[model samples]
Target: VESATRTAIEAIRTGIGTKPETEIADATEAEAPVREVISLLGIIDGAESDILVPDADDKCPGGYFHCNTTAQCVPQRANCDGSVDCDDASDEVNCVNEVDAKYWDHLYRKQPFGRHDNLRIGECLWPNENFSCPCRGDEILCRFQQLTDIPERLPQHDLATLDLTGNNFETIHETFFSELPDVDSLVLKFCSIREIASHAFDRLADNPLRTLYMDDNKLPHLPEHFFPEGNQLSILILARNHLHHLKRSDFLNLQKLQELDLRGNRIGNFEAEVFARLPNLEVLYLNENHLKRLDPDRFPRTLLNLHTLSLAYNQIEDIAANTFPFPRLRYLFLAGNRLSHIRDETFCNLSNLQGLHLNENRIEGFDLEAFACLKNLSSLLLTGNRFQTLDSRVLKNLTSLDYIYFSWFHLCSAAMNVRVCDPHGDGISSKLHLLDNQILRGS
Candidate 1:
């Protein structure tokens, strides 16, 4: 290290190279700020600069790095990623793991995290009331902190993620975001939030807010326009909540939303336009709800880009023809329903589907034509259904049928008042498979 520092000192003393300002003026196009791809190959490429360091003349630069001995430089992001750019290896020493970069990034910006370590077990610190800052700018991790209310005066505005999970907050007030307006993601799962004030996120639409996770909350109902339109949000997670109803205007502003999760809710009814505003929605998780029926009118318009739809563990008794208007649907989960039969036209519209799960239903019979249009289907699960016979034409059009699982029965003895050789019932080893030759008959 001392030798390298002496060499640098000698290089500085002997005017063998041009000054740093002249090199900057000759290399770049008169300060056209290069946005991305800051490579440090100038070491071997023999460019004007030794490394991708910021020009010495540019004032108020965004980011830069400098070595201790050789005066070489690298980008700020290249510090802790298993590389030794400095002559003294200072950048790699005491480096935190990349996965835990959030913690170090906050510490680098002088945000507080461990100040309340001496506070009472269940207490919280209000903004500027305890420490100089309210929460960390990269993250507001108060998990398991037993917080009741979110304070009003946060110190930073450019928050990337605010996590308050496992707390005891019951409601979300409009003033909750009065200070932290630029938070991109908010996670409040297991916080017991029952109600969010209308317009709680008033000015967040103009910010970069994208994902909102409120799973495992106590919200029984949400007001209309919960998130304003043109918000550019992509994912919304409300799973394991007590939500029971949905209106058309519930998502008027979430046109760019891609995934919506309402699993384990009590929603039994919704308007035809429930998903009308989400044109780019690709994944919809409605499993474990109280849905009773599905029809074409239930979806007023087609979801052209929808790829996965889950309605499992519902009370679905009837599925109308053309129920799902998604032409790009690849996976459909209807298992654990109460359907007794699948009509011939029920699944005729799902031509692009690859997997269909009807397992654990009370289904007694289904027309082979219902599956004829599913030319691309590879997996069909009908396990645990009471099937007395299987149609010979079931596998005729299943050109891409790669897997089929169904329970087979042999005899229904009136004397025993029970089914005898049911494969799934009596654990009997069958001589011939039920899904191989198409026609299934009992003894």
Candidate 2:
């Protein structure tokens, strides 16, 4: 550049002397154009450039903007290029500062997200060309998209429901959805999830993520404190997974959790206090598992709000006395097992139970007062058992029985005033005259 400038200067000096008297004015007027050329060259020599190379340790060096909370740096040219170069995708946000104020007001008045009364599960429509997943109202559906990770370039809106069903997220890391704090329901069904970090949901403690469905996965067990304490998560479904066992610490301080479904797993026994911490739990389903017995001491007595519990289709051979100690229990499903005896006061604590299922078992005897305390039981199902003759006096106190189902007609007489008795007649007794069967009179 210096050599070129010197050559121009030398040529200008030669032109000044070589010019005639008439052309001297023209050469003098050209000096201003030569100075402009020199000024343009100075900009190219890094003397007035806007961008500067960076040295380490600074959040963002000169002319480079940092992606919020991350160490990544992007150039000024990439700021609002309609691309998501940041992990949290904060670069594209607030591109037009003047338009941001009006945009949020429009969003708040027109399409309010996380408002339960304004949202509905309906068909999805593509919002624009920028989104890969179709959205409707506050929901973003990405089902069957074959996505291995969450899409990076999503609209910066408060999402209420995010459905990623049929994806292949084998592991969920910590703070995976921290940026999407307003999501209320997350559906990851059939995601083949095998493991999750311990604090995967720690960042969602402040948000209102209520429902999480991770069914039909390959999760063997959950990490301790997988869900942080004091979260408002209500329903958790881990059904049909590879879960083998449970620990007491698996669920610690989920006070707002109402329902826990662990059906179709391989749980053999309940760990003490496994569910004692869930004070608001109402429904628990543990059916179709590998449980062999119901130990009275292992069952937690603190589940005062528990109303329905299903432990059917297990290998339970006997139920100890006071097996079900929940005071508010309304439905107890213990059918399809190998039970042979009904211990006295087994369901005494469950005085509010309305339905009791004890069918499809090998029961041959029952203590006289086995169901003495179940005065509110309305439906008693004891069919498919080996009891040929049941004592009538044993069930004479259950006056609230509206429906009683038994295998043999002789057992129907044990239910004195039941409105409906199944197996109407076996060539012996009819529903109208249950005592007509000679075997019932003999008992």
Tens-digit lDDT track of model 1 for 83-121: 566678865665432212322231232212343445543
Task: Mark the regions of model 1 whose C-alpha exceeds 4 Å error after superposition.
Answer: 1-138, 151-159, 409-443
Residues 1-443, candidate 2: write the lDDT tens digits. 64444344445556542445445454335444534533532223322223333358655653356677676766443455466666678766765433113222322222123333344544433344456677766677778898878876554547767878899889887857666636778888899899988888787678778988888899999888778766789988888898888988888868888988887888887786889898899988887789998878867888999988888888999888887879998888887899999977788888898888898999998888888888988778888999889887778668777567788754655664554455533543222122223343342
TM-score of 2: 0.67
C-alpha lDDT of all candidate models, in order: 0.64, 0.71
Pairs clashing within candidate 1:
229-253
Task: At residue 195, give the lDDT of candidate 2.
Answer: 91
Reference-based lDDT, residue 228, model 1? 57
> lDDT, candidate 2, residue 404?
72
RMSD in Å for all candidates: 26.7, 39.4
lDDT, model 1, position 81 = 39
Residue 431 displacement (Å), model 1:
9.9
- State TM-scores per candidate: 0.61, 0.67
What global local distance difference test value does model 1 have?
A: 0.64
